[model samples]
Target: MEFRGLGFVPLFIALWCTAWVVVSYTLTVIYGHAPLLMYISQTGNYYPENITFKIGFLGMSNATLVLMLLQYNFILLHAEAFGARQPMIQRILLAMGITSCIGTAVMSVFETDFYPVTHRVGAFCAFACGCVYNLWQAILLYEVPGIRRAICHIRMVSSAMAFIGVITFIGCRVSVYTKLCTEDYEKIIEIISISTEWLMLLLILIQLVTCFQPMQHLSLTVSRKGYTICKRENQDSAV
Candidate 1:
């Protein structure tokens, strides 16, 4: 499947997560230098400034792993929505999960450029994903006539999470630009980072909420199957 359009979902998630890591590292390095790092200089001290860069890059790598996990769940959710029946979806999701995990492991071993410009590819990918998912949900709501009635709850939740993603992207970009304004622009960046982090976190929480409800429904359905199987077994024994 050409993820040309769906590519952004993973991309943006990476960007938001990376930004969180970088900003946090920046705060830590600056704070470590002096109580006044927050007041005077945005880049902190010069000699050991590379430490923040290393720390931020490490944070980015960790966040990417978390993003990959979510992507696995997303692929499963995609397969389920497309009607893979139980067994097929399970196998497909497992394969995709394993592949993504392995790919991430390979990437983790390398040390490469961590500049924002280089990282913007991830940001662009994230924007693309967010937009595509929004469109997909809209299509699901309007075009897919079969499950419209049944999926009202799903649509509502998906719409809310998608909206948050859009808002988070805009907020993060603005904060990044603001950080470039002056020497001591770090404080404002820190504030903005905290806000965006919470926003992205809210998205994570929403995903968790969606994940559990479906599993709950699936468990109930499986229990019904178990009951039927047991009943048939007892009847055969009686016969």
Candidate 2:
């Protein structure tokens, strides 16, 4: 069956990843302003500095908005799929997803150079909440009928990778902040930290792809009251 609304997930992933790649490359290679191992936020630190900074800022902001819309779609898909019989776990997942989306927006808006504290808080919320959401989602999917076992396995693996990435990223970041390593060691630690951050982000986006199958049979409609998601009838039959 043709999936409706699956485009949102891919669009979110593509926009963010492209932004990161283009901005990071421009700063490190073309502009020679930032180191290769600099944090993602560093690429967009001074928005007035260059066009790449503006692109990074705008890209992340737009991606966060798309992420929020994707979360809403997931909530509606769950509501229609399970109806009133939906479990509390589903509600909790929806809440976590929304919280992560909010965190993403905050992080995108508050650059680390200008708003260090707020940016850190937003990053903490986005990564921590998002990691928990992925693990919990994997567990919940096991209980859901008709979901493929392979998808559940993939989710579980992706969640574990994200969890590991978070821990490694935190450890390396803390080591750098504390000056626990020598000057030479600091660069290595920084590289590891940045790499893990990228890994965590990519895994989070990958996990969202698992939802595409579940959403294949669903479609959204809007009426005078509000928006509603409904299962699509077989197109062949309608024809």
Candidate 3:
């Protein structure tokens, strides 16, 4: 009857997907500024040159920040649930998830056209750290008795897909830079890279859905200390 933490899972996914769709549609259909096969970063580039750039930039940056907060909360929940079994592993997972989230935010904030080096670095951090985090989480879930076996298996498959997607994305991009392929081949590779990037994003979102069931019973609480500046001390404390 109570789905406390489950709402955030869908909310995060919806916001992310909505942002991508709105920005992509505006750029490709409304403005004709980019083709359908453009990479995710391309949608947000050329700030101040087009109104769509502002839409893409703000949408992605805010969405990624929301994702960052969601991931941080999820890591805290996992640590609370499973920290007793593998404290060090929990710490590592928390670090990796947060790093990936921050990387995503960085990439979203720094458009590829304006900040090429910084954007590439951010993309590398996001994908690489995110891949490790997903795989590690799958392994961690496997060792837990309370979690469903189906969820563990689903995470394993999704994580594997994400790994392949990352490899394909990076390989395609590298091939483009090498200039070893013909122009036609370069175009094909670029399309593949863009498709793989989207696929990887979907896989990551699916992985997040797995947390819903496990976190259904969990609820977040906020409290203020009696000694805080905004509040008076409790009568019991004075006594």
Candidate 4:
């Protein structure tokens, strides 16, 4: 069995998820229940697991995971074909990405209201490791010469922006914990933190969006009950 032209799968999934999340959060706010400045996963915490959690949150998390999986699959092949020396780093990044994805789904299932402790732990894993995933990929991209033409400056720039966002988020939490922030100050920090988080994710997805230029011909052929990158000749093969 073979799957050709599957490159856009991740890109489409990213776009769909991003739009859905914004729309879901917008609806939640518009309904006069959710507050003005909402966290990305805030809507998911609504009691009874509203449609936002079921479709928007779950759908976005899983879809992003699938997209990352696909992107990393391409990265592995791209590295192998290009002769990247550090296989260990790429493997670690891939593993961290996969783990974060699983954590995202798990966190979604156990909302913050229902299971605060467990959800916080899972969120930490998801976002913390998620940062590593993006940063590491950017590292590899910079170190590897073969993908320079395919991966433009946007990848590097976006990765840096995402890292800045993480730093801002952590800084906000630290300020609050140290009693350095007043109630109003904390609220302002939270809003900035939320915006940064969203921007980081949006940029990450945008990086994937541009990936179509180079890997749009990525072949996903089933082999030995797994998938392998097939050559152009196998483009039209069926199961």
- TM-score for each prediction? 0.36, 0.75, 0.75, 0.80
User: What's the distance in Å from true for residue 151, model 1?
Assistant: 9.6
List model 2 lDDT by residue over 1-239, tens digit each: 33344445544565566666665657555566667666776765653433455555455545654554554455545554554745565567667766776776777677787898898887877788778877876765665555679988998999989988887887887787888889999878877888888777678667766666554445567667877655556533211
Choose 1 or 3, whichever is better by TM-score. 3
CA deviation > 4 Å runs, candidate 3: 1-3, 6-10, 47-85, 226-239
Candidate 3 lDDT by residue in tens digits, 118-148:
9888888889887987787677667544567
lDDT of 4 by residue, 1-239 (tens): 87666756767767776776777677768676568776766777664335656565567667767666666666666565545555666677778987787777777777777787787677777777887787767665554333445466777777777777777877886787687999878888878878876787687687776556445546778878777764344433311
| lDDT value, candidate 1, whole model | 0.41
Worst 10 residues of 3 by lDDT: 226-235
- lDDT by residue (188-215, candidate 1, tens digit) is 6655645554464455434433333222
Identify the candidate with maximal lDDT: 4
Lowest summed lDDT window (length 10), candidate 4? 230-239
Candidate 3 CA-lDDT value: 0.65
Model 1: how far residue 172 lies from native, Å: 5.8
Model-by-model lDDT, in order?
0.41, 0.66, 0.65, 0.68
What is the Cα-based lDDT of residue 218 in candidate 1?
A: 17
